[model samples]
Target chain A: MSTTLEPTDRTRIRRGRNRAVADRTELHALLADALVAHLGVTVGDHPVVLPTAFAVDADGPDEGGTLYVHGSVGARWLQEAGDATVCVTVTELDGLVAGRSAFHHSMNYRSAVVIGRARVVTDPAERQHALDLIVDHMIPGRSATLRPSTRKELAATAVLAVPLHEASMKARAGGPVDEPEDVAAGIWGGHLPLTRVVGAPVVDHQTPAEVAVPDDVRARALHRA
Target chain B: MSTTLEPTDRTRIRRGRNRAVADRTELHALLADALVAHLGVTVGDHPVVLPTAFAVDADGPDEGGTLYVHGSVGARWLQEAGDATVCVTVTELDGLVAGRSAFHHSMNYRSAVVIGRARVVTDPAERQHALDLIVDHMIPGRSATLRPSTRKELAATAVLAVPLHEASMKARAGGPVDEPEDVAAGIWGGHLPLTRVVGAPVVDHQTPAEVAVPDDVRARALHRA
Candidate 1:
């Protein structure tokens, strides 16, 4: 839990204005909390960002060493991006900061940026582990209840693993910081916090009514609600 | 509100799998619902994605013709990416679809992808309007209550506008779609809906207790909570 953040050549934050959190522990926590990531890959000379499901392997205390992103084998981006340097970013918008003046308005957010080369996970054992980790990452303990993947189904999926060594986290929280004059002007200034709630589970219509909802599904449904 | 999607040369979905949405109205709704965007910009030959606050100008029915992004003038990504083709993506994760088998497990999300070139907004009046649009975008009726931006504050901020003509939306919702054999296995299958809640406001400590929270703030606090 005492991991430090070492800024790499590309992971450094150049703006440095209102960047509140940059520690490795905080980065790991943010990565664990977010379920989806916006992955950036080069399409010719321009950059394209796609929202995809991602999971980080649990190796340390809230620290996932490698990030695993999966897609269909027919996905053009995955097929074209062979061992290419890419970026994976996960962001959580916690609140909206309202300042006394229009210019100072900002958001309270936690973001993690990982910059590295992604290699296709070819080994069957590691690929299986990555798939399970992804399922459990979204819903803890849900993977154990599900059936394993068939060889044909596994062949249709493509898994990519990116090392988390060159990564950085940045965050901002708390109330608005208005200028001294604006504060004295007595304009209302505060922050409206935002939280994510998991709603009740909706069972599939095709499922039989006799089957009861599993504990893992119910637990996550009520968690942070 | 019946605008169909026009597949541009750049914004077309090449992988055509599980892309449940393509209507322009749906794309506009997703863009309006999301507050933060992952902006992809190039630095030398590599792509970097940064989480930033953005606002879409409302012109048609939930159709914002231009995407406006503002940041500090000193930000490196904004500076280096002068008139470069950029992709701005906004995504909302609605649910986690858990199938009976690991292979069919997926996520329910609404994502909008815009591919275009961003130009720095230089007109003073347009820049002022863009700043106010961003403030009101985060919180409705917020800009009218706060004081206007000073000349110095306006100068420090750089606003970029990217046309939203070349854009597309993709979404997936409802329960998991499992195979027939997997459905017969009787393993649990459902979706856990994720929602965003607005928590109570936290006022600045330096502010006097007599200053009351504005109605706009209180209204949004209870909205969609």
Candidate 2:
């Protein structure tokens, strides 16, 4: 796979062109860090955007790679997404840029958008792998410890694969950019960094007392902090 | 306005009906707490989803209320969005639910979807008000402290307003819900609560030496922590 992202006509960045990032590595990193992605699909004449858990396979069987998103088989949007053009977006808010003037106030964020025609996963082996990737994406080393999924469970889930060939990323960081006159006003101008903090685990009430928090869970909480 | 959200055919919750929220107050609270919104619009045959800062006015001049999202006036998507049906989604991921079985794993999140035809804000006063709300939404009491937007700055920004009448919200909270058989296996099952933390201000290097961090910035950083 190429190290740089090749933006197509649809993926080209027009506005805020200065913030556009062509590095595929940055796109992969942003996807790995974000917990949720919003999937957009056209339903009839209008569009619908819903949040769902997503995972990516950098060397999967697709044009560039494969991006996987799963939903209940009964979900109407999931059924409508099959063989249809879709857009998936993941964003991380980094900070609040407080400029000397309101016109310059903005946000520090990293956002990625992927556009492709989604194909429903039909092969049992590939579907299983995609499901495991989704699970492990949320908690590292999680799917390895779980038992094999039952047939009923497998039948109840639907996985959609979107080729990562057409993807774009944009990010903004650091302090606010205020005008020279505003800077001369001697007012406060800066940014407050935002972060996602993971707290202690809240054990399920039904879990047996002998069952302890897994090593992966403990490590993730501390690593994210 | 009605106290409860009236979900239209497009806004109805078809899957995970248990997590659907019907109260208007809950929708307002979710919108207020969220900092970014994903806007989905159909450009030609495909859909495009992008993240942008958003604000809501509960008593604004719209059907139920008004949702404001701004972008560069030269943006292609913003130009296409005028008088077009669009979907706006805001999501807050609360926790990672670690179920004993991979099939049952999910994330606890609060998500709201609004579907409507966006109208470009042409009125000068309303556009100015919307811009102020967007700035204050990021930092409370921020817009009041800054100078009024210059005429050139106002001309360079485009604001789109979507009515909140056809909106729906769904949220999942607490621990994982696993099958009885998986629970009997005596494996760990719980959730790790996630939170957004704000760090100390990073003042711009160009700011005058005498300038100090403003009270609003300090208060928001501490409050969000």
Candidate 3:
């Protein structure tokens, strides 16, 4: 994989060009950090966007890499997305930039957009690996502790892969760019940094009293802290 | 405005219909809580999804209400979005559902998708109001403190409104629904609740020492807590 992102005609940043990041590593980092991705596909004559859990594999079988998003086989949008052109976007809100003027007030965020043709993973071995990655992406070491997916469960799920070749990332950080006049007016301006807080795990009602919270789950809570 | 969400042919939830929310109040609540919305628009032949800050007006001059998203007038997508069919989605991840088996693992989230024709706000009064709502949406009572937007600023920004007439919301909460056999096996299964944490406001370097962090900003952090 190339170290820099190769922006295609559609992936090029036309607006807010100053915020664009050419580094491919940043795209991977943003995708890894984001838990959900919004998948866009044309349904009939209109466009539809839906949120889904996503996982990325840097060395997967795709042009640059593979971005995996799974849904039920019965999902109409997912079925239509197969072999069709799609756009996947992942965004992480970092902070709220408070400027002296409302015009300058903005959000500090890292966002990536990838445009490609969706490929349904038909290979059993690769499909299984992608499923594991999706599980572990949410909670590290999670899939290993759970029972294997049954054939019926596997058949019900459908995984779609989009190549990471034509991708572009843009990010904004730090304080807002307020006008010099506003800054000179002594108005308070900065940012309120936001972070995702993972709370304590609540035991399922069906779990036996003897079963304890696993190490991986506990670690996830602590790591976020 | 009706109390229930009016799902059109495109906005109706097909897959995971169990999670679909019919209450319009729930859609309003989710839109109020979410800071970013992913907008999907078909540009040329492919669909493109991008994240933008959004605000909702419950009694705006639209069919049910109005959902507002703003961007630079120079933005190509925003320009193309006018009078075009667009999809706006807002999602909030509530928790991670850990099931006894890999097949049952899922995420608890509230997501709303609105499909409608985008109308660029032309009236100066409504456009100004939308801009203020966009600002106050980020930090409550923020626009009141900031200086009024100049004509140049107003000209540079473009606000698009999508009626809330055709919208659908889906939410999943609590623990995962594991199979009876998996639950009987005594495997630990539950959920890790996720919350958005707003950290201390970092003062801009350019701000005078006399200028203190505003009360609204401090209140925002406390409210999120």
Candidate 4:
């Protein structure tokens, strides 16, 4: 079965030039690769945006997959977002596109935007599964290495589930596209790609020396490099 | 002259645990290191967040510095954000902290949150200067090589200025803070640091071979590597 995103009224790209990646497979891959998401929700009249860890199950039963996000029970945003409409955005800065003119300079990036009303995950079983997905999303096979969340810990956390029905991913890549006149001006212009890498893991000071770095952690850190 | 941010009612972090970097000097440094910012503004009743390029003027007349953000004139968010309150957040994810238990897993990040009303920059000269600052902010000395914006181009852009007076920077560094009980379980737990690096510039295929890469571009790519 081919997984494709059905664009809704809110998902349609109003700015024609900003639409880069429209294929569902490519958009899903971009969302899966992102480690964090910026969640936006209104509190009273003002809007607050937070950088948060999130997970999306691409191969799940849901047609377009579902985005999972969690926060402290005491968080004001969390309180305001109870069954409220929200916008979750994930952006990866890929490169800097330097054009020969000041107005043409731009950045190459892959960004996904999801708009939906988040429903609080209340079922204990589903909540546990969602938590596992989040942990594994950060580090593959990480959920198996750690102990399960306690009842008290689960009660202190608030997880929101937003279906990926209204979502779109836009991307820009490759070199600078300067105008013909600017290109002939002889000013050097191109693109500098930026990459995100992982460094060596630092073990906890209190942990015993026998506790070695797990295969999952070591593999992810090395894979990024 | 010290450029320190003053915390206000809206910017003051209510959640004490989330307040990581309270010192203004350290917070200012964290903001300077970020490349992109997430802007949150209300469109009608819904909140929309956009990942955008921004510039901060630390040495300028503004006390805590001013954040300059520009967008297309046709954008709905830009049209609705005329002298309205907004939130600008810049986050740099430093590392992933894997704890011995699922509940304690967290990320090490440096984030700055600025909450205030943004004013539309109407002055032509100030707007041009802001545009240059944004270009040079992405790549140092980049604005001088590029041709200045034309009258039409200037008219097509909407620049907003938000003073950094009501802002706060919060950061979390180092390894995972696992509980003693979980640590005794012998699970491998630590933090994997993430770094952003820049790759070699790829010149446009249509450009002539004689157009060598500028010193600033070469230095930036090498420094990131």
Candidate 5:
């Protein structure tokens, strides 16, 4: 498939043939696993990429086809993304895959970048759903536990819906790039792995004493630790 | 102090006078927390930012103050950073600190971006030390675990030294911003905390039964999670 940006000649690290990827399931998995994404917005010629905690809002029956991203209506950058076309990139590094030779050293990583135009959602009815998506993005089932959004609180948030089909994910995982000659020379090589873990959750000092951790939250805590 | 970049300007994220910071200790901590950074280089205004795994290399006793970064010499980007004026950024998002007001929605984050010209270190002895800095950057004691680099490997690695004085770190930690008009809205807001955790060490399935997890690696694993 032809890319909208054509891998601009100078920006292409490897050849288009080397870096181009075509896979949907792989892309979805990457989007689901990442908790944050670096958003790049360009005004004039300069581009500023800011990392933001984000969750993917999949298309639903009642919703138009748009990837929902909710952030503080007060945030300058978030407001920009909500109003214009932007690039969202999610990346995860799996490990340091060592090669036997200098040229062979490499990393195992998965990265996905999506480009789309978004419009701020102002409808009162849709605003609550957007907040629900944001809440669900963090703790899957916590939306039900928390009180629903009030009319005033809903107005304070800005939700943007960006179409998600125009996206791509690229990944390289496995052993290092080792030249046969280097392997024979017997230089030690392999992968130094990496993983994300969550420590024990610290309860909020202001949380009411009567409330206990919900089942889903407890399960997530166990997974994180 | 006024920043060259304006706070609302699109060309860059201009530092607010109160938000801008210049401190070596803060810079160092941000760098220590980050394992990968986007090294920005401008080749005659054709700017490019590439992600690379890096480790800190300390300038020796004689050098009043400089920071060293280690990477593959074969990687043109690393070599370029060694000789050119560049900006290296390290950022960590501790939590999404929400406040009672829309304007106050903020985050607990620490970020350091060093803008400077990197000096190349070519001495054989200094090169070895630089390599050690890179190794120890990942695992403090593991540098001693592996055999020393061969002459060829050392030649292929690039070590760049940059003065720390020119660098700065920007940090923000607090609750949300609520307009006085919205003070009585009674919306719940605080922090949606975040952290990087290490999980159970998934030892290589092929590892021999005799080798056990090293103490330094164990400490790091427990500390981050």
Candidate 6:
């Protein structure tokens, strides 16, 4: 776990005036918490973005780096985008930051945009590991409980790992930004926050009778409503 | 609303062989329920996407047609992207669909991408309606609860409404896509559902006791846990 790159572009790509996190660890944590990301790539002259369930590789957590892993090779998007530069973005919607004035209206959100070259993963061991990370990223400790992939399954799959040492984050939290002119307008502008919580776990109808919720699954569930 | 002059190419973009979603109503529902969207555009040659809170104004039902509404003036994007061809994507991560094979792994996701000229809303009445729609989108009863926007606030702000009638929706759901040949592989792969919901309500520190949580607001708190 050696420190590799220091975040530059503070002047240009820094959080700017917003309160979104930019630290690699914080960014990685946010990526770890998110279940999916919107991956943007240019398809011909058109920009195409796909919703994907991605995972951060557990084996590569050193140096403030993040490796996002996602699958399904049949996507026409990956076919069109061989090794193109892409932007993978993940957002955690904490709540809506409602303000009085329509101008001051906003949301409380945390988002990260990773810009890098996209390559289809080929290594067997790494691909398998990436798949495990994808599983564990969803439910922290379920990867071990699931059966491992077969050789043929590995061969037919495609996973990409992008190092996120260079990226940017933008966020808007708190109530609102009311100008001096707006304050006197007598509008009771403030924050109406929106939050997302976990609901009571609905057991999959197909689960067998003997299988109960595992400790890891219950741990993740405790955080939600 | 009369059907506006919409080009064919504007509506039907390229297709994703395994991921293409041809349903029009499905796309509209996804857009209506989504509270935010990622606005993807090119900055110079690099693809830069900004995730902003957005709301869609459905002229009628989900399929009757809708328009995306978002605010910000003086922002480089809203200013530079006056009626320029842009891609606005809305997505809802319903659940995680684990696959038996690595290639079949995917998510239960519904995403809509609209490629068109995002016109800056100019009419005062329409702008107010758009603003109200944006608020109403986040909280169904918020627009009526808050005071209306002032003339000065309206003068400085801009809202872009992108037509949703000409948009395309793509989705993937259900259990793993198991290849017949690999059905005997014994990889216990299946979907792991994920969702976000409302947690315990934290009253605003300054909230007045006089104004209690209305049925609309309290209903979210008492929603099924």
What's the number of clashes in each of the models?
Answer: 0, 0, 0, 0, 7, 6
User: What is the lDDT for A168 in model 4?
Assistant: 76
- DockQ scores for all predicted structures: 0.76, 0.85, 0.84, 0.73, 0.17, 0.31
TM per candidate comes to 0.95, 0.99, 0.99, 0.95, 0.66, 0.81
TM-score of chain B of each: 0.94, 0.98, 0.98, 0.93, 0.82, 0.84
The sequence of per-residue lDDT tens digits that candidate 2 reaches over residues B26-82 is 999999889999999999898899999999999888888999999999999899899
- What TM-score does the predicted chain A of each candidate obtain versus native chain A? 0.94, 0.98, 0.98, 0.94, 0.83, 0.84
In model 3, the Cα lDDT at residue B159 comes to 95
What docking class should model 1 receive? Answer: medium
Order the candidates by DockQ, highest first — what do you get? Answer: 2, 3, 1, 4, 6, 5
Q: The CA-based lDDT of model 4 is what?
A: 0.81
Q: List the residue pairs that clash in candidate 6.
A: A95-A194, A96-A194, A197-B197, A198-A224, A198-A225, B98-B191
Off by over 4 Å in 1: A17-20, A58-64, B17-20, B60-64
Q: Please, what are the lDDT tens digits per residue for candidate 3 over residues B1-225?
A: 899998988998998889999999999989988999999999999999999998899999999899999999999899889999999999999998888887888999999999999999999999999999998999999999889999999999999999999999999999989899988878888999999888999898998888879998888877772
B1-225 in candidate 1: lDDT tens per residue?
237766577788867545746677787788778889999998777789999888887451123377889998998889866599999999998998878888888888888888888888888887887888888888888888876778899889998888777787788889888899888877668898999988988888867889999888888788863
Worst 10 residues of 5 chain B by lDDT: B1-10
After superposition on all C-alphas, the RMSD of every candidate to the true structure, in Å, is 2.5, 0.9, 0.9, 1.9, 6.5, 4.5
lDDT of 4 by residue, B1-225 (tens): 344656777776777455556676776676667788999888766777888998887664444668899999898888777788899999998999888888888888988888878888898988988899988888888788677788988999999988777788778888777778887777777899999998988887766788788887777788652
Model 4 bad stretches (over 4 Å): A59-63, B1-4, B16-18, B59-63
lDDT by residue (tens digit), candidate 4, A85-171 = 898989999998877787888888988888888888888887888899998888889898777788899999988888777787778
- Consecutive 10-residue window with the lowest summed lDDT within model 3 chain A: A216-225
For B1-225, candidate 6 gives per-residue lDDT tens digits of 433323256445454546666666566567766777988666555555678777776572323354655645666667655666667788887665544444554567778777666677777887788778877776667778765777877887788877665676767766666666554544444454556554444444344455454454455445421
Docking band of candidate 4: medium
Model 5 lDDT, full chain set? 0.56
User: In candidate 6, residue B183 scores what lDDT?
Assistant: 49
Candidate 2 residues lying further than 4 Å off, grouped into runs, are: none
Which should have the higher TM-score, number 2 or number 6?
Answer: 2
* Pairs in steric clash, model 1: none
